[model samples]
Target: MSRARSHRWLRRPNGDTTPRFAYGADYNPDQWPREVWHEDIRLMREAGVNVVSLAIFSWARIQPTEDTWDFGWLDEIMDLLHEGGIGVDLATATASPPPWLTTAHPEILPVTASGETVWPGARQHWRPTSPVFREHALRLVTTMAERYAGHPALVAWHISNELGCHNIYDYSDDAARAFRDWLRARYGDLDALNSAWGTAFWSQRYSDFEQVLPPRLAASHPNPTQQLDFKRFSSDALKQYLVAEREVLTRITPDVPVTTNFMVMGETKGMNYADWAAEVDFVSNDHYVLPGPQSLDELSFSANLTGNIAGGRPWFLMEHSTSAVNWQPINRAKLRGELARDSLLHVAHGADAVCFFQWRQSAAGAEKYHSAMVPHAGADSAVFRAVSALGATLRDLAPAAGAPRRPARAALLFDWESWWASEQDSHPTSRLRYRQEALDWYSAFLALGVRADIVPRGAALEGYDLVVAPVLHVLPAELAKELTAYVEGGGHLVTTYFSGIVDENDHAWLGGYPGPLRDLLGIRIEEFAPLLDDETVTLDNGATGTLWTDEITLTAPDVEVLATYTSGAQAGRPAITRRPAGPGSAAYVSTRLGAQGLTPVLARLLAAAGIGSELPEEARGHVELAVRGDGDTEFWFLVNRTDEPVRLPGVTGDVLSGPTGGGTADDPLVLHPRGVTVLRRPAGR
Candidate 1:
């Protein structure tokens, strides 16, 4: 069977075939009085809102009792939206259960690793492995699907909101039983499970499947492989819940597509979304800007990864903040032009649908202070004005609605298994972070104005001229062979510290460090020399290294030393090495050189790989460029990366949307501060 259902898009209530961006927010009519809904729809039209994801967190209101369902309010709002020509991505309203259900069945509540029961005061308080929770949730799914199957305003089905957000690691008896069942399916027998988990260590072997338990709060660090498998099982358990809900939705309303929003932002790594993308009709993501210097870089990296997870197809931008969000420690309002700039950045990365967390600001709730399309100041506010202008901008750029993200010359490999395994206890430096290293590489690409794709581990590698795999600590044999083949087929490969050290089972490669790739990289390390927090090492190339270092030995006659250590214990030794393979080469970096330090280092590697930026020299670091299109035409999205205006030269195209401007042979195109401009140009430009 295919990995995912064919790409399905939202259609208008009138069934119009016109190509336009899906625009709106999470409409919560249930949060307001019935009389205020008319004003909501009127403002929606003014903002050019065509679609809204409705009833996401309305479970308590939808079902006040086990036998009672209050659909009268829902029916009225559905008819009102259709009359106003707005389509709906109708949610199943199972994001949370009613207070009555939880009070009746407290067994469905999750248990922490410390053996404490999680109370029902917050959202997502139920366990994924609880049969009682599934039975009640699926009943709600069935009722919603049957009632809205033929509704004119219905466009898609929004599944449970952000699965595994809080309840991912349940350690109750129910979860123990389900985890054992999952392990049986994976290993088949206790003997095989022992071999795979290396349970012989520390006298931890299990005689039968019944002896296995989650790596809960233990006396000391639990078995490493067992802990890794528990992480895997937690993600799989939630994926199974999503599958159960989707089966009912597809069975009742097969024509309407189904999707759940994925939180693909900073450090929310409980779900393996690449593995889950195959189960959905279309992929949708919720991204919020993290504060700091690398905030925009992190957003771009997440969007790039999400687009690749959808196989470069058009996906939905489900939820983002209009200004300051309530959840942050110090929620700062967005500066002028950031609202449109952020939305268009996602559009540049191939998001066809743009939406926020809500339509109207709340009067009373936990998230009452969260920014929305209509803030507390109402339609007269600057936020609502910006939202209206963004809607108009989306309409103007309708021609680029379904364009796929154009492939780039280089890619950064991302692995969820490696991420889960690399940071476990009893390993190297605890300060080592997998995602931060990957983001540093991405930040280098952005600084150099080089467009690089962030691809999952199993994605095709042959399409790129260069591939950078950073901190790929888990080196399963199959991936090892595949990466070797990629290099033998004339592809340049670069990897960093702590890579290729362990197998899928978290067992170290016996012969030496960098076990599987030692030969391919033409370098071997006898020991890892991790540095202290205050320690630093200087490289011969004028770059500073921190966190970790390796004493590398060249094993091949054709190996070349690119850079040498100058101040550490391994002074005068190779800090970076490269070896020529069949038609390409493999390189290794032994330490962590941050974004600024890696800029010149990457310039050299990019030069060797025959890849360079496409922007003008003067605008290389000042402007960010992303392209999206089918083969016949292209849309060039240029975003100003700094607070100052930039003059872009040597570009020619018809402006689709932006400040009115053009550049000639002598005159340059002007980009206002924090502005985004889209240009429609011919393909292969």
Candidate 2:
């Protein structure tokens, strides 16, 4: 089968495709009375909502007792939605086990690192590795799948609601047992496992797989490799549950696409979605705007990351905020026009659907004040009007659905294993952040008006001219060899300090500062000089650097010094080095350069690699431009993140939304503060 058609769950056997942008929210009919549900569907139709996720948190209502099943209420709801011309992303209601299930099977409750039980006052109380929890969840999923196999209202089958949101890391005895079994299966023997973890240090060597345990409380730091393996196991444990539920769904209804919403935003970092992406028939994600200086930038980064996870195939925006979210410490409501702007931003980055946490506001719950399509106020409110307008705009963008992102010229190496291992305690500097360093380099590309794709560490090096690996603390041997071969094969390469030093097991390379990559960049680092909070370093190239600095030396005559420290004890040493590797080259940045300092270096690298920004000259400094192409058609997504009105003098195309585009090639493109425009232009326009 073709890759596109292999997704039989998405493209139904009847050949009905999803709308351009699936617009709706988590529809909890059980939260409201029967009278309110009719009005809810009416309002949904008015707002152009074609799909509503149903039965997400309805396990208790669906199956009240252990033996009894009550599909009458769900039957009415599904029939009502079917009559109202609405499609359903039918959830299996396996997110939170009901109170009875958890009460009867107390073994299912998760345990913390300190051996404290996670009580069931809230949701997501069950541990993923608990067999009792798995049994109950499987039964419920089977019942739902069998009951709703051929329901006309069913469009897509949502397996569970936000898997691993609260139950990602369980430190119970059950988890320890699972961890040992996982290790045994991975290494096949205790000898290989001991070698991988380098257990000879501190006399931590294990003679048997049963002796292996999850990294728990320790005097100093727990084994770093043990911690890394636990992180991998935790993600895989949750994925096992997802796979179990998916098996039930697919066994009953073979044509329905099965997926679980991933909470892939903010500081939540327990589960690895790249590994979990293969288990789902289609990918869906939940994201929220974080409160910080770089919130919007973080939003774009996450949306782009999710898009990349889908392999640039269109995915679903499972949840987002409509106004003020209730969970933040100081909840700030979004300003005017923020709703549509946020939704369109996701659409620009390959989201085929836009949805919110809920359809109507909850009056009695932990998230009562959380923003929704219908706020606490009546339907005549400003939030409602904006939601309706966004729905209409999504309908207008129907023609541009399923367009893949244009090939990126530059790639940023993002690895979850590295992210997990790099930030573990006892490192030279605890503040040597993995994601922030990559984001800092990413922001430089954004500032220069370029689109760079974040790719997996093991992804192919083809089609990319330049690749940047920032703060890659855990560098496996194979990847080091591949990157060196890439440079020798005429591909540009750049790696920063704190990288290429450790192997996959978190063991040092034993040679010099940079273990395997020392010869590739023709530089050897003697030691890392991590700066204090009050200290700074001045580079001779007229830039200030802080956080961390590496004392480096050029090892070969072919290497050239790009920058040297002007101040500090290691003054006059090479702070940056580049080596000519045949037709291409590799550069090493020995310190953390702030946004201003990295621009010129990146510009030089990109120029040497023959990659330039595609943004028009007039729109370079003012607008955020991202392009996606489908055959002869191209979509130009222009977002004005600043306060000034952006003017594109020589650009014109069919304006899909907002005020940045209109008319033919001679017309000037204009955008106001926070304004977004998606212009459709054919090839060679």
Candidate 3:
């Protein structure tokens, strides 16, 4: 299950063998006049641009009317970039179909749950399971691969841009047929399908496979298992499409690696990226900073998770913003020092390449206002200067390229199924956010200056001393056994409320709440006491709980109650509990205590696990530390998490690249507002 298959990297256009950080953006020369092309090359050299993803959304331009093909402009750009010593991640030009193709075959369009056609005014309008769409897309892909197979500027192949960003869930006939096939493969027979779906509950049992359809618009809540299976089928449908494109590219141009950008930021959780990680040559992600209180913490969490998805190997920061993005509710420009800070944070996690969405800001399209390397204000703007500065910083830190993420003593398990199932309809509480709970725990670790890796559910958990699985709601039998074995083999486990409540089939575990984990946690609850929006509860540990609370009855003699409710309907009851198993322990938090509230609780757990802050005590909350590299040397990325300057009393390392000041074991190092510093030192030190 390891995603360590890719050992290849971006091939140098000029064949330079030196290891260097990849720097570039998505190049869209077709949007502008031919004269601007030369100027783009000149500016690219000035800003240290090395690679560009080409022809991502150029399907219409590449195939004007489905009969006419245009490669003249593409040929010129490819030659021009090679002359300028730049490499190209050439796209398949299948992100969006030409208007003629869609107009001719309207069946290719996706349909909503209410049986409405998804119109094509925007991008990603084609359905993933449409055979007509696949035919056209594969034709375009084969043409591009054949045309650029021998080009020196060609480094990799970019599959359809952000595969399922908009059209993930299609309820059209094409989707229904594909969903049935997926279900047949998964269940093997009608009896197995009925058993897994619990179809007898609502007289939804099916005797024929043809009667089975997607969990479409229904009278009542669609069968929970049906909905879950549909989600799985949709993701698999898209993954199969990706594999189709990848197979073609690999067959034609076997040396060239292929990758698609994954949106792993915020709540864009439609696609299961952990499953898709192994399908690509290397994992690449497109992340945008969501404006919120835990914005930076969320960025770190996303990056950490992406790194682990890449199997701790160096991945790609395919697309990010140099300034404000146009898509948010109120897009605000990035504050000073934030541009470099954000890019470096991705590098700190495991990205060897740093790229933006577009090289030049658009002038007429929907994303015209989106920020770019060369913004609408041109090269003289602050954004361009910041981009150039980041380019220079990356060049100076070339030694950090190819370095793997340093594994932390602790890990946080992130499960996509848990996220999907826990937030489904008819749940105990609609206010619960699975990702936020995991991020809150990550923020708590940040607050305590303790590093924790955010790993996927099935990832190996043998090395981590303490594993925190926040709201792991969907627990299959095999996974249940795995967790039990992990704890019994001296791994400390911690999970939250609403976890282990259901198995893989979306059926309750039958015994009690937190069913499979009850024995390990040594606690049992009869039912859930979800809180209203305005409700609040106080815990004896000085933590405020919200969203949920559980009354627990300890079943093990060694189980200990760590915190109790002091002000709620369940007064004086257990709010947090822990049970020891041999040399290991399992803890449970029966209430939702946010980042601030979770810090104290995490401190206790970390102490018991013998893990402490790696940073100076004074710099705990203000500065974040991420390590990279292997045995002999470690690259420490110290990021200022605040807008104010942070001082570290005793930080020691050879300054690789950073702000003006340096720190010894005796002197204090001052980091500017939103600044980041990279230090290189012996791993032992």
Q: In candidate 1, what are the lDDT values of residues 498-539, reduced to their tens digit?
A: 999999999999888798899999999999999999999999
Name the TM-score of candidate 3: 0.99
List all candidate RMSDs to the true structure.
1.1, 2.2, 1.3
lDDT of 2 at 147: 86
Better of 2 and 3 by lDDT: 3
For candidate 3, lDDT tens digit of each residue in 333-378?
9999999999999999999999998899999989999999999999
654 in model 3: Cα distance from truth in Å?
Answer: 1.4
- The whole-model lDDT of each prediction reads 0.91, 0.84, 0.92
Superposition error at 170 for model 3 (Å): 0.4
For each candidate, give its TM-score against the true structure.
0.99, 0.96, 0.99
Off by over 4 Å in 2: 1-14, 17-19, 660-666
